[model samples]
Target: MSLSVMILEKEGGLAQTEFLEPSRKGYCLSCLDAVKTLQETGRFGEAQNELEDALRESENWREMAVACLLLGELFNKWGAASPSYTIAIMEKGAIYANRAVQLWQIARDEKLFEENPEDMDHLSSALYWKALNLASVAGLGGCERWTVLEALQAATEAAEQMSAMEDKKHSASEVKARRDFVEGIIVFCRAKALEGNHVSPTDFSDCYHQDTKDEVNFLRHQCLELFISAQEILSAGKQTMCDQNIKATTMIAVTYRLLGEREKAISWSEKEVQGRLQLHGEWNPRTQLAKRNLSMLKGITDEDEIEEDCCKLFSFESARSIKSEEITWSLDPFKLSSTWRMNCLLKIFLLTGVVKEFQIEEDKLIKFLQKVRKSYHDENPFHNWYHAWSVTHCAFMLMKETAIGKILGMKEKLAVLIACLTHDLSHPGVNSDFLIKSASPIALQFPFSNVLEQMHWDEARSLFEEGRETNFLSHVQEELRAEILEMVHQGILATDMQIHKQIVNSLSNRRDSLADFEEDDMTLLSDKAMTVYDATSPADRLELFKAVVHCADLSGQVMEAPVAYSFGRAVLEEFHQQAQREKMENLQESAFMKNLHE
Candidate 1:
């Protein structure tokens, strides 16, 4: 009986030893360590392989959690290479992250005891990874209210879980650092939710425990604070290393601007500019923004002064007409102003070689001018004619510059001249918005304001077609017709300011590209094209053109201060008359009257 009992005890002891052997546990640990090392070294493929090996060896919830977390991170990194893949990768990442969370819960429930800091760190790391994945998924899912609400809930829960873990007694510093990191992320998620137009905070009422407005404001403040803190930390070391701080400052300024706190926005913007300028120089992008904003702010007050200065710069005077031509239109015996006719003649002479320079054929020029003057006597305004003429004069002066003159072909030069001459030939004496709002017959015929510009081109073409061909087209060829037409069309379209800035920016980039080309290979034609392009560009030329014409259109305004004041007074009276008409008709008050009062 004693021998049988000894045999049973020996066998049971052997079985227990085998089950609890250190070597078997060490092997499992080594597998986990190797997988982590691979992941740390960024050998994602190798890390995946090792993780699979570790999982096969352990088949436990802890190892499974680590593997899923690593897989999610790897995929997330890959997705960042392209925005188009963000949604796909984020979806997959969310799946793995959720899997990691589930596995971690299982491991926690099992209550496996481990003395090493690595075990606790792994759980914290899993939570951090899960939060990041959830946040990414939220970002990629876009602004759908329901979808964002769901994502915000998930991210909030993950953040809370992380915070709770950090509060534990045995939490590692690394774990606490991760908790802090995720706090910023939570703030970012909340800010994104508020800022996005589609995802209203009210959509998540069931999950949202706080007041929507208060929550949004709190999140915005939290985001700003975190950004400021990060910037402070980054810039704490050296004065020379403040790039990150400058960027953060700009972001804060932009946020303030979005929030409608203009004063704070401006203050922060000034700081960014001043800081960068002190660190670098005036040419820096930040400094440029500051200067531009300052200029814009000053412009409101300086516009009248600037307009006066521009008028003095481009002084216009009536030229002596060769013949005292009395032209009659529908509006009585209108003696055509000889000085005005002479000014038009001078413009033609400067712009085209249609007549000899020293031996100017005053007769031909005067005849042409008189005909155009008579044809549009009722339709054209003095300001519109002068504006077109001034722009043409500038274009002519620009053409005389060595760089522009050498490259522009005869055809292109003529197109520019003709474009300048006819640009505002058929102008109506009101702004586009006024015309559109009033449903003026011209505006009704062409629904698009841009088409009004096109009409000018068509009128010019009709004039040429009606056996009124000018000297500029003498060398024109049938083959070059398409190109000329395109140039003219572009030039007319350029007079519209709405799309001017974009076109100018494009041309500027092209000019920069051309600057890199060798001098011998440089084509001034391209440069001339850009010059014409800039001159003809809508907003490009309109703002300047409007000011020029407004002054010239009202040139009678500055004939003397009293004359100018009377003109201004007359304009005010006309506005008051319009307001009275509107009131009687029960129509909305016109913007013209509003401006007059303001």
Candidate 2:
């Protein structure tokens, strides 16, 4: 037997391993089948319940291992959805992964190998994934946790398993090589995970001796040593040093920086930044993070500047004139001081002329709009319906102020205004990041991606499909309705700052693509007129629509000092509440706290 097999047999495999007696396997299999179906449908919360039930009913370790591993993966998916509670969610996944290893061990101890020797392979795979989970994220809570060291031990043993696997009989040349590669990977993973933990903020409040300079320096040296070993092994076969190349290099930079080797740190970190940009492109979060780090190192900073909201209140007689066909709506006369809901709808009416142009049934659409307004939680500090109104107001202003020839078609314009109005629909006084990190049911429903925005899109679509009354687009052509629906999705997704660079670049690229139309179309219109009601490329038009909505979403940040600062304070209050929650649990606080403190 190979070393891994021998090790398993020696552990406790002498006993009979058929603990389940084969009769209960059918029920476990059916439960697993149900889990698979639920997972496929993105019903993660439901799938988790089924898997936990199977675990309770499992008669043996093999069945337990399967359940544990699947549960671990689902927990990870759930964590990804928890944008704010990611730390807690990921920790839960790690717990499940670690438990799976224990279950696999129990199977070996029972000598289940006599029935299916292939169980060893499952054990090996489980160990590797467990190590990966340990290394994937930080923010583990509790006072006496052994995080990095524990992860390193798991990874080291996993690598040993791979090394033993290579010597098994009939292990083809390719199989042996693959094992060799993965062994190297596990080693690098150990090194990278160590580096990750090394940088994790610790309680350095004099109460902890390990938080001192000497201890910190020693930890850095240990991390540097591991990265050097990883760099040599993983880079030996290729010039590119594909796996962990940037990670190792970045760690080296971080180590040097910690040691006060400024020049060396800058040199290595610049290389890491370049590699990240090349691999992930300019718009990726990793690329942005690296760029931000580089800028900090270079001592470059950008200060925020907020312009005034420019909303001025007008008397009823004067504001009423804006609705006349003869009078034009100008930003100067509009005020968002009071009557925000009325002004919000009035702005949209002014922009789209839906009632005048399309001749919509007034009571039908107005009542539905009221429902949409009421849906927003009035208690939200910043993301309430009022905030949504402000965003819509900004979008309307952008459409009107920009040259008509440069504006999007009527349908696109309407979609942007509508999107801004409902972008925060059903906002629970919490951000997407918060919901995602908490692994709330909503996050599970949208699992592993775009947690909040996807839910918002779902809400918006739901309202649209509520009935012809709320279907606001029922009067529009079928093709236009579909376009409007898609625009809503794109517009909402574009507001995600994680991909802000991509959205900006996409819009900037379109400026050039549509420039010819802008000039040619402008010549066909009057000097004072603006807007190109028709566009050549519908796909390109959506990009512009997204840009408009994104700008409006960020409008609060650009408002005049009083308004902008007020909104900033509102956001900060929400974050303070989140921080309070973290402190109560002794969990790692939001990174935004550091920014706020700074």
Candidate 3:
């Protein structure tokens, strides 16, 4: 009897069925039949038990391998239903897959399938399934990093082997199907490598060292190539059983976007969106995700236009002015005459030539300064408007040192100053770390923290949104907007600590080419580079910014001991409130707070 018939018999009646096939005379295909019936009926636990019983009675390597592979697939599906079962399911799957691979090797070595085409196919199928199981386990997070690496290596080898077999003159249709299956496995491994724990090897391994960016870039390219190959193969067939093509295409688009290939990324995304919409008809999860991504891509393409539209969507109201005589600080003693100073500075060294002195718009500058001041937290001490003002002045000072300072001149200085002052305006009173750890909805929406910095540009755009009558950049050409946006995005993303060290290291290594100094004056260039480097490096510049804002946020701390004490108490109270919420939800407290309490 065929396997399908045995499955039907087991489902129809819980009786041991005997097959008349010569090869299966002593084999217990009935055990597989029972497991299949149970699995089809959604009785996973029962199916698992049946498979375990079958394993004990099975002596044939082929039968044992098939049974184990089935068990692994069943466990994988069960684990998807509940995360609590993930570890158990993954462990069992790995164990069975390993066993199947070993059995396949033994069968091949014993020459049991030298002329048996059916048995040879079965052995290869077992090996392919084993690799699939390993890849799936590695894709699930919390597995050891080495396990993922090994799985990826195994999947790649299996895929190459299958592809070679498919190229043979007498290769069967079944061989082609197996080859496609292996390709899918390879793609899964690529995605896992990209999205899984991506920390540097130093964090977990003692023998291996690899540059994180280089590794990510290599793997990302591999995924794209595999995706393209899969697409070509899938297109040749009218229909594919695995649905790997669409999934691989989506991942390729996402990876391209992550790699900053905006144009190609947007193209792939648009294609995926159109294809899915044609297939699914309406707003399913895939369609919605595609739409959202398309919207983001459009925003990136014509940022100024989107910002203008947003401003037209919402209007801002001016605050009511307070009477000078009525203003009092009785409740908060720190609200008195406390001297505020900014602790950080941004020095912009202009390499181009300059011009002449022009009239300074003092009131406009003060407004920009005030905007920066407002970004500071009520308790933060390190950052404030003064620091912004200092940075603006430093940039101007550097500009004055350039030949371009003698040309169109003070207008450029005013522009740079205005940019610096308004850079960090409307601060959210939290660091990037806080945003990431809290899984703030904004972080989820963008998946890139630097995108949040676009908020500043948004605010800047608001001023001219209404018919461009009051728009500051409205007088400027549209061509300049894209260039300015790029500069601003780069500067803001540079502030993030995660990418900071890498950026600095890259700069340091390329100093000779980037410094652009004469041979005799190379020493001067080195010194200048060091200065610029130190000013922007995380250890110095970022720390300075943090300290400045932190001090400004806690400016009240300097007023009186009691006032500082109250501020600290309020912060502690907020932490306690958050901790209570986490406790109620059965979640652990944040690591920082957990450390504090311990």
* Top lDDT model: 2
Which 10-residue span in candidate 3 carries the lowest summed lDDT?
Answer: 346-355
For each candidate in turn, give its C-alpha RMSD to the true structure in angstroms: 28.6, 23.8, 16.7
Model 1 score (lDDT): 0.50
Among the numbered candidates, top TM-score falls to 2
The reply for model 1, stretches above 4 Å from the true place, is: 1-60, 78-81, 113-116, 142-146, 166-180, 205-218, 229-598
- Cα miss at 438, model 2 (Å)? 1.6
Q: For candidate 2, write residues 1-598 as lDDT tens digits.
A: 0111111122222121311122333435545564445534434456556656777887767677766665555455444333334455556566777787788776667676543435555565566555545544432321123455555455566556645643333234433433444344343333333333443324322222343344445555665666655555555545333424665677667667656666777787788788776665666545566776665444322421121121233122233555543222322112344444454465456546655564455544554465566667867777776577778767776666564325477777777877887787787765666665654556545554667787777777755541323555657654467677888888888787788898777644544454455644433223332232235667656766787788788887777666777778878876776767667756566777534544
Assess the local accuracy of residue 119 in candidate 2 as a C-alpha lDDT between 0 and 100: 56
In model 1, what is the error at residue 189, expressed in angstroms? 2.4
Cα lDDT tens digits, model 3, 264-286, are 77787787787667654355544
Ranking by TM-score: 2, 3, 1
The TM-score of candidate 2 is 0.45
Candidate 3: C-alpha RMSD to true structure equals 16.7
- Lowest summed lDDT across 10 adjacent residues in model 2 is found at 1-10
